[model samples]
Target: EAEVAQSPRYKITEKSQAVAFWCDPISGHATLYWYRQILGQGPELLVQFQDESVVDDSQLPKDRFSAERLKGVDSTLKIQPAELGDSAMYLCASSHRDRGPMNTEAFFGQGTRLTVV
Candidate 1:
């Protein structure tokens, strides 16, 4: 079975520092997504990418956060001047089809946990 891969399972950074996380979605999956999960809340979509182009990023904080999937296969998410509120789990997911009722399943990575101090 194929699975999404993420680097640096854990991260700790200062409030004003910058942090970045990497993810490699399953091969052949055309849709990729980045999500943020606060401790007790459900995952929130930050960005969605189809191939090398962005499909949606309405929830991503353009001022301090950015996500890119240049080659359309792997991606990176970065946060500058990290804030305590930014501490959470960053998850990457992929699906073979576009987001819709037909595409009910998505494979997700273990996620990268960020902690800001």
Candidate 2:
């Protein structure tokens, strides 16, 4: 089976340092999403992409976070000057449709767990 790709399954950084994570969605998927999950909370939507265009990023902390899907295939999420509160699992998911719930099989990556001290 094809897989959504992610790397650096774990990271440790001092507070205020920049960090980045990468992902590659399943082939042919048109919609992609990035989520952040604190230890016990459900994943929070950080950004969504339709092809190469951004569809939503309202929950992303703009001052410290940014993401892009330049080729509409792979993507990256970056945190500049990360903070302790930024410690969490960063998951990357992809789906077939950009809207509606019909194609909600959002495959997830192992996640990049960031730890900021």
Superposing all C-alpha atoms, what RMSD in Å does each candidate have to the true structure?
A: 1.6, 1.4
TM-score of 1: 0.94
TM-score list, all predictions: 0.94, 0.94
Collision pairs in model 2 = none
lDDT per residue (tens digit) for residues 42-88 in model 1: 99999999998999999999999999999999999999979999999
Task: Give the alpha carbon lDDT tens digit for every residue of 1-117 in model 2.
Answer: 999999889999999899999999999999999999999899999999999999999998999999999999999999999998999999999989845656568999899999999
lDDT of each: 0.93, 0.93
